[model samples]
Structures are given as C-alpha cells and as structure tokens.
Target chain A: MLDAFGQPQSLVVLGGTSDIAGEVVRTLAQRRCRTVVLAGRDRDGLDRSADAARAAGAERVVTVVFDASDVGGAARAVDDCFDAAGSVDMVLLAVGMLSHQRDELDVERTREIVSTTYAWPAGALTRVAARMSEQGYGRIVVLSSVAAVRVRRANFVYASAKAGLDAFSIGLGEALRGSGVAVQIVRPGFVRSKMTAGLPDAPLATTPEAVARAIAAGLESGAPVVWVPGVLRWVFGVLRLVPQALWRRLPG
Target chain B: MPERTLLCGWGRTAPTRACVLAPEVADDVQRALAHADARGTVARGLGRSYGDAAQCAGGVVLDMRSLAGIGDVDQVTGEVDVGAGASLDSLVRATLPSGWFLPVTPGTRQVTVGGAIAADVHGKNHHVDGSFAQHVAGMTLATPTGLRRIGPSSDPELFWATAGGMGLTGVVTEARVQMLRVETDQMLVDTDRFVDLDGVMAAMEHGDADYRYSVAWVDCTAALGARRSGHTGRAVLTRARHAARDDLPPPDRHRAPSPPPSTWLRAPRRVPPHLLHTLSIAAFNEAWYRRAPRHRTTELQSMWRFFHPLDGVADWNHLYGPRGFLQYQFAVGPGEGAVVAAVISELADRRIPSFLAVLKRFGPSAPGPLSFPVPGWTLALDMPIGPPALRACLDGLDEAVAAAGGRVYLAKDARLRPELLDTMYPRIGELRTVRRRVDPEGVLRSDLSRRLGLDRGLDRGLDRGLDRVGD
Candidate 1:
C-alpha cells in the first residue's frame, strides 16, 4: 500500500534480479517502503536484490523462487509470493529474454523465447490481477519494450513476443478497470540492462534507473502508458506510419 | 472491496492514490479493517481536512461517508446519535426545524461527524462554548481489537485519545452528541472595524465575552502609511448570537426555523493562477476591511452569511490553481498573543500574499491530548504554494510557536516536522499508550501518522503494564 505521499509499503517484484526491477524496488524502499518480496529463478541473484533493498531502508525482504518459463506453475509462484508478503501493494512483471534472431530459426529456441517472454508472464499476471481485484487495490507494472511497436527483421521473434505480451497486458488492464486494480504498461526504447547487454545501443538507449524513474512517476500520476525516453511514443507514432518497404529496410 | 483512486484534502495539494472502500455499515468497516493490507487502513470522512490526515497512501482508506445514518434526535436531552459519516450540513438540516443546532461548527458545515470529533474542531463560539468534543456524549469505535463503546465517563483515557486523535486510534462509527437549542435560525450580528491589530485585540479581549460567537478578519498586507497612523493590520470584527423570534421579520417570526440552502453560488470551473497574487489579495483585503461598518449592531443575518460565507463558492480551492495552496493556522496562549502579531508582520515583511487571515479567541482547551484549542489567540491564513521562501517561513513560525508554547492545528497541517510533535502536544505519550491497547499492531494509520512518526513504538514494558491493568 502507498501512503498519502504515493509511497508503497510493500512490493512484489516477479523478476526481482532484473536490473530494472531492482532499481524500481530500490527507489520505493528509499521512500520508506517497508516490505519487499523478490521472486526469481536465481537464489543468489534474488539475495543480492534483497540485500540492496534492505540497505535502501526496506524493513523486511523475502525472496521466492520463480521461473518464468514454468508456464503451468506461474500462478502458484505468484500465490507463493503474495502469501509470503501478506498483501502486495505493487507487482512488477519484469521478466524478459532477448534471444538471438539467428538462433530463432530453430523451432525449440523460438518456442522458448516466445514462452518465456509472453505466454508465461501473461498467465502469471492474469492470476496476480485476479488476486489484486479480490484485494480491492493493487498496481501491476508490466515492463514491455518499444520493440512491440514494430517487429524489425533483426529481432523479429523477440519483437513479436513482446508485441503479444504488450497486447495481453493492455487488454488485461481494460478488463480490470473499476475492479480496483491498475495496469501500467512501460515501453522503453532500449534499456541498458543485462538482457540488452550484448545488443548494440539503439538510437534512444536509456538506463535502468531512467526506466525506473518513469515507472515511479507513472504510478504516481496513474498514467496508463509510460514511454521511457518519452520521445519514443512520438517517434513510434511516426515510424508506424512509414511505408512497409522503408520500415523493413531500417536496421536495428 | 476498495478501488484505486486519488485522494486529497480540502487544500487540494499533494494528492496520493489509495485503495478506497466506502463501507456502508459498521460490519463492512470491520471487514475492511481486517483485510487491510500491510500499508494499514485509515478512516476518511468528507475529506474536509486540509492535509494528509485522511490519506493512507497505498493503504486501504475506508471512506466513511457511506455509513451516514442520522438517528432520531432525543428531544428532551437534545442528544442525537449520528453516524460518523454524516456531514454537519445534513445534521443542521435535520435538526434546525426542531429548534436545535450543532453545538460547535467550524468555518464550513461540510465536515463529517467523525471528522468533527477526530479533529475536535473549534468554531467562532470557541471562546464561549468550547469545541465539538465537549458536547460529545459517547461514541462507538471500530478498533483493530474490536468494536468498543467509549465516552468521557466510560473510558476517559481512550475517549480523549480518540478525540482529535486524527483517526490514528481507530475509526469512529457513531457518536451521541448534545446539540444547542435555538429560538431562530438567524443571528443578530454586531460588526466593527479596527484601525490596527492592537485595536481589534483590545476590543475582542474586552467585549467578545458578551456574545456567543466572535471573529476578526485582519488585513496583513497594509502598507507602512497605514501603520504610521496606527492602522497596520486593519481588521473587521463580527460578533453574533442566535436571534430571538422577535428579532426576525413578523412574517418569518411565525414560521418554524429552518436551515439555509446548502450553497447560494458556485465559482467558475477554473480560475487563473495569477488571480490570487499579492496585488489581488491585497486589494481584496483593503476593500473587505473598508466595506465593513465602522460600528453596527442588531443586524439580522442568515446562517450561511454569518457562519460559512466561503461555502457558497463551490470548488473555491481551485482559485489557487493547480499548485493549490496551504492554510497555516497556529494558536498561542493569551499571554503570548505577541507571537500572532509577529507572524502577521513576518508574512507582511516577506510580501507573502494571504487572501484570508482570521483571528479568534478560544476559552479553554479540550481534554483530548492532541486537541488544538487552548485558552489562546489563534490566527489562520491561506497562502499560495509556489513562493520559494514559504517552507522556511513556516518552519520559522513553527519554532516561534513552539517557543511560545503554542501549537499548529494538525487538521490543517501538511508540512509540520516530526520532532515538534512532542512540543506541540505534550500529552501525546498518553495517547500512544491508549492506542497500543486498541491497535497493538498499528493496523490503523495515516500519512500524517508516518510523517510525524506518531506510530513509533513506546516503552514495551510500560505499554504492557497499561494493557494488563485495562484488561
């Protein structure tokens, strides 16, 4: 819950080890956010995030094992996180995998990328949204990418998965309207996080802290959509209208 | 179930989103409290508080308005059991025909019964009748432990703790309060203008006791020329009392006394931000001071005109524009009245525009530990927020007030420092002990509580001993 200053008391980060998620949790903790639940696949990584949050003034830090690829077990993972924390004021869905487009020619690799990026997260967030609705209030912040705006050939498989996740999150937000739950879709141009480490810097590359700040401001203002390096919203608006041939020729 | 929504106080500043649930009954409130998340829960009434007292931020806010249900008034005792959510406006409308009125009403009647009690609001009649809590007989509170009935006699400690407790103790569900009987709905007013702050203070000190209600509007922006003639901080003082039937027109005298219309006018949808700048406010103050009669008496005035003039202008807060404004109100004992003068002069020296500055005299303090009123002089002013020096000026005022053994009204505070809580309310430790008994886990909290460190744990051994003795 957030106090009158828009400071949340407890937060549940699904991809706790992700750089963006860590930054968001750290920022909130500094504002007197007391409880933090970190859920991720790596115990050591989750411990590191929890330590950082505690140092940032979090009173309690709990870590739960979460594997985004375990589609069938996603709901249980969410339930475990909530059960450990009691009631979570916010849930950040920050799990994503940027698979190499060349490896995506293999059907298994494509399925893995799509499932990890979209199917699993979509299922987990749907269950979390239901709990939030039952609890009467919760903010679900989904970290989508600007890649969802247009699927470039260089990273077509990853972009397509992001597009699907983005559509699903937006639709879920609409469904949860008036049910006391809010969904904030974050589309960052290119955040320099571990997932995007090996990739070349994009035109409007941003840092994890910048994306975290955007999320914080978005939550404060109750903005439904947030564009990190906010000019991306307008740039994408124009790029989407470009001719198909010209759009295809543009490199990543 | 609660829904995420933006909540702000009357000041319309620093809005925060929260999960708000409008609980229609005591049971609903209890259920909501039970299920409140880690951020805890706080009860909110009409949102009339000028600051963060009602906002819980990220926590569940129980909007008590849905619980509004006014029971029948006890004609013999003039006592009524009103739901915590019931607004004073509705109470006035319901009781006026029966020749009864709220014992105390603040500048506005939009406040809820719970809010009136939690804030222990004082009115123009404070010098004569005291504050709202004095007339409260008893109340039912939904505590984290359970629902409990408390009163001055039944449980003096807990009752006083909850009174002006800022909803930190628990949620008040219903209260039995005594109302004053009135002969007519009108007031026979006496208006007088003073050339300077000293003149007004002397007049009020000498004559205010003659009337049941008195207030003075001071102009803090007057120039040095006015001061040279002993006319600095010129003021208009109004004193009034409920009119007798004979005081009304013959036609109105024969009819039953009725409450006035809720609102007579509304402000425009939007007011330009610059409309309330120093120049405009200064002009308004000058005109307002000059317009009042030099001296007049036996003027019949409607309740709306006499009691709540600003209520007529709906969304009047928007006049301050998007940044909103702050209302800084402080009270110092009668001996320290000089502090009031110093503050007004400070504002004038800084050229900080205050559209409305009111000065009043309070008779005595309520028993509530955190209650604002004392036998003192209180000054309240409204100033826009953008001034760079406003924060420092207020901080300086806080120090001056503390040094003078005065305190700012928590109901109107948004920026008070935490360390000054002990200085402002010396008995806060007692309130904390009582709170531990009812809400040991601190499930009931608000943004104001966190900001002031009001929820910090006390000596555990002492608290446990108190709890055991009570049990």
Candidate 2:
C-alpha cells in the first residue's frame, strides 16, 4: 500500500466515461489513482457515468466531454482534447454508434456508420496507445462486433463497418503486444444498451452489466480477445461454413 | 551512525525512527552501482543538506550511511577510511581521540562525507581550507563506465566537476578525504562588532584574512535606529584548534529529535500572527541583539558550539512564525559591491527589517556548472512571508540582482518563474546538454524540470494546430 507515500499517482482514461473506461477508473481507486477525466459529448451521460464510477471507487473524477465526429477538422479537436487530459494512462473510446439495419442501406448513412464505428475509434486509440507506450505501460480496449465474422444480408452494412474495425483491432493488438500493454478486444454478440432499448433482441444478448463484467475480467487477465456470450467463439466458428447466399436470408 | 532515524526537535537534526540496513560491504556498494538506473545517482547519508542538493528528485539517492563498517585507522598519518553513509559527527567522534579532524565542517555535522563532497560544503573556515571538496584527495564515484578511482591529478576536471556538482555528475561512495591534525577538540575564538552595514563589510574584509574562521550574526527587525549598527554584523575568527581531550562536540547539532516536518507551519498555527505587527518585530529584534556577546574574546569553544551556535535550538526556522519564511541569500561580486549595499538599503528603506542577516565573502568559483559562489561579498536574510507586497519586493530585488549580474541559489528557491531561470544562468543550457548526453531519452525528469521547462520537447501540437492560443 502506498498510504505512506506523500505524492499522488496520476492517471488518464482515454474513452471519457466509456462503460469499461468508467470501470477502469473505479478499479484504479484501490491503487490511489488521483486524476480521472472522462471525455465524450454527452455531458449529462458522462456526469452520470463519472458519478457511477466514483460511487464504485475513484478519488478525483473529472469530465471533458468531446464530440469525436470531426465536424470541423475533428482530428485537431481530438488531439487538443488529449492535451487537456494531461499524461493519460488509458483512453477508453466508447464513442461508437450502431445504425439500424434498414437506414444503414443508404450510402450516406453507411459512411457515417463506418466513420464513427471504425475510423474515429481507430484514429484516437492509436494516438492514445502511442502515448501510453512511451510512458512504459498502457491499457486499451477496442470494442468490436461479432457480426463482423460472417455477414448476412439482414445486417451487411453494420457487419461490413464492424469488419473494418475488427481488422484494425487485431492489428493494433499485435502492434502493441510487447509495448508494456495488453490491448483487449471485446466482442460482445449483442449488448442491450441505451441505443438498443426498443430494438428486437438478438441471440446470446448480454446486458450492459454483463458486458461490463466480461470486459473488466478480460482487462485484469490481460486477455487478448474476449467474446461476451462465451459460446460465440464456437458459434462463429461454425457460421464460417455457411454459404454467402444462404447466410443472406437469416435474421440478424 | 546511530541505529535510529532522527529529525530535529523542530525535526531538523534529531533521530526519529532509525533503520539499519543489512551490513553494506564492498559487494553491496558495487552491486548498488549496477542496480541503479537513472541519469545519475548520488549517495545520501543523513538528509541534512539545506536544499534539494541531497534530494535526487527523479534520480536515485543511495543511503551511504548504511554502509557503516569502520575500517583500520592509521594513527601516525591520521588516515582512516569510513563508510560513505557514516555521519560527520560519528567520523569526528572516532577521529578526535587520535588528534585528527575533518579539515572543514559546515553548519551541521549530521551531513555525510558523500553529501559534503556532493554539495562541496563550506564551513566558517572556508576562507582557509576552501571546502570539503578540496580535502577529498581520492574518491570512488560510480559512473556509467564503472567505479573508477579519481584524485585531483587523475582527470582533475572530472574530479572538481563532481566536487560541487551536486551529485549530478556521479554517485560518491567511500572517499580518501583529507583531515586536519588538531591540538584539541576545541576552537579558539575572537569577536568583533560593527555598528552599521558598511562597518560589517569593512570588518570582514580587513580582519577575516588573518583568522582561520569567520562568520557574523545580524538583527532583522526593521526597527528605525534600533537595529545592529543599523544592520549590525558580529564576526568570529578562530585560529587555534583545541587539544584532543576537549569533550566531543555535542552530537550533530542539526539532527531532528522527532517528526516535525512542518514545525514552521505548526508553530504559526498555534500563535497566529494576527497580533504581530511592526512594533512587535522591533521589540523582538532589540531584545535579540542586546543578548549577543558583544566585543567578547573567548579563550576556547567547541567547533560545533562556536560556528553553529543556533544548532542547539533545533528547528529555529520555525521562529519566523508560520506563513513560513524565505531565506534570501545573495552575494555581490567585486564589481557589484554597490549592488549589495543598494539591496540592503532598499530593504531598510521599505522597513521590511530582516530578523536574520548574515554577510560572508566568497573567495572563488567552484567547478560545477551552476554552483553559486563568486569572489565578492554575499548576504543572507530571513523574511517572514507576508502579503502581495513581499512578492513585489522580491520581484524588484530580482531585477536589481540580474542587472548586477548576480544569480540566485537553486537550493533555496521557492517561487522563481521558468523564464527568469534561463536569464539568471546563461549556462543552464550547458547543464541541459550534459543531461541529454547522459540520458538522451529524457528519462530523468522531475517537477522542477517541467516547471523550469528543461526538456521542452517538440510540442505535439506543432504538427497540427499549434497556432491555437489558449484554445
């Protein structure tokens, strides 16, 4: 215990109030983490998230809500947000959006989905990873989609977007393997989140609570990849055998 | 070395909770050198040095006092090899019976030989022996290359560089430092009093050269017409050393007896200064100066009692009454003697009154790049922190000092801005260049480095919108 030590130990969380990010904030409290700033757009949501994080455990939690949509050269703003974070340890990017199956069919809609799902998280996490690596140790979590494994016509746009993300996640994990960090890729089949509240349930659906639990477990174990339903790894293995034409007819 | 950790009653020099390291023998010191991974490391015996000189912020501070196995002593030549971590008082206690003594002892004997060499400490006798560094004939300072032995002649540059390098150059282990053959464990003394600021400066310059030891005490109360020679100076010059039979100098004067980290703060808390005013300060000063032994010549006095008279009180820094105090010590070189007089007169004019004013003559510059000594006169005074006015006064003084080509001591600094440091020490870049060469990755970092902008690495935003002003 560093109770006898006088100086404070600093920490930075990248994903600004991401559920898993929030949990990490709570976790480091036992180690006496002094500074925690959650960055995201939803001030109300982040405030609630930080409150929940503090309630769980955190010494000093802060909020720096940001819009990662790159509205006006968003990369510059994201970079600026990082400078404000000051010596960040982990950047939990929980800013991704999920598009409905029908609306994502439009090219314009698909582009938005692709950027938010894959491009924004990828660009930001890479920067965060590079910084943490230089500091000697870093922890990052890139939430990927299991729909990416075998795309069906019912959800091709969403699956296609996640496909790009899944590839980037794996590559980042490999790149950061020995960089004093263990990048954890969480593939939860379906999480009943605020976005999916009125939507129909999918197979092996996990509650946000369950997803948070699996991610916390994976991060602590330094696991390379985590499948939320536990059986999806095998189910996806079998789904690979399905022909594309037949797979197109199945309900997502 | 004592078996307990000590702090001054004010927690300065008294042992508090002592710890004993497993016998650190030859192998321990050698292995420690290999184990340490930093830009540079310094051995710390007792953490008694006035400033961060003993505190390695981002670097390692090897506790040399832990290696306390005494070796054989040469009675004829008065040659002895002591552990680096061993305390000065312990060394003195062992050598005194044999009529041998450390040639130079600073204000406190609690400091380690390793620390003394690292800081190049000087005592009242500095006008004679120079400093502890001059007495060190040979040293075993660990470096990246290996533990190499060095003397004044063998690579003299590196030796002197390490002498006052504040442990930035390398880690000092055991040293073959020179010692003085003494008549006894006593110091013969004389006292001279000066009525005014000019009188004090003249007295020190005219008479200090004739004696082996010299120092003065001045009253700080800004009382009109009631202070020391209006800023009095008390000087002592000791030439004869006491015989071997004199009682051992009281155990390390600076040692803290308990855990009183903020005695300065605690006392002020108890007796808040809401009642203290200018008149009160004047009354206190008058009482203090009246008690001094004026125009007295002592037949004999212990070296510790004579030079470090204040050490007996422990944590005397607390008497400043808690908002804490700033010990502003600056010396004016030959060309800038007028700068010294100007500063003193300015302080007097403002009625800021110094409770502790000391004047000393610096003989020569040390080898370290940033060591704070120049040939001329230096003055130090303790000011009880007050308000915005205090900041203004210091700012004004800083400008005057800079104009006079004078510099501030890094060890005692509390509120210097990053920009001023660059101007004060033009050679700061040279030290930074040496730092870069030693550890290019910039792993050796501290709050001081960040505050002072030491490694102003490429701003990450330069590639993007570095143009944004406070965006």
Error of 2 at A125 (Å): 22
lDDT of 1 by residue, B1-471 (tens): 334877778877656567788889998888877776556689999888888899865568898998789988899999999999999999889998999988999999899999999999999999999999899999999998888899999989889988899998889999998999998889999999988789999999999989999999998774534444544578999999999998888889878887877676776757776778877777788788778999999899987789998888777888887556789999999999799899988888776778769999999898999999989899999988766557568879999999999999999987776668899999899888898898876778776776677876733321122111111
The best candidate by TM-score is 1
Clashes of 1: 5
User: Candidate 2 regions off by >4 Å?
Assistant: A1-252, B1-43, B56-61, B68-79, B223-284, B315-324, B350-353, B418-471
Across A1-252, the per-residue lDDT of candidate 1 in tens digits comes to 443233466799988999999999988886546779999999999999999999988887999997777899998898888877765678999887886758668898888888889998999998888777655467899999988988888778888999999999999999987655789999999888888888899898999999988887776556789999999999999998889899988866
Compute DockQ for each candidate against the true complex.
0.06, 0.02
Please give, as one word, the docking class of candidate 2: incorrect
Reference-based TM-score, model 1:
0.72
Model 2: how far is B298 from its true place, Å?
5.1
Query: What are the per-residue Cα lDDT tens digits for candidate 2 across B183-277?
Result: 55565677665556566677777877877777766554556565434543332223333423333345532232221121122223345542344
Interface RMSD of 1: 10.2
Evaluated with DockQ, which candidate comes out highest? Answer: 1
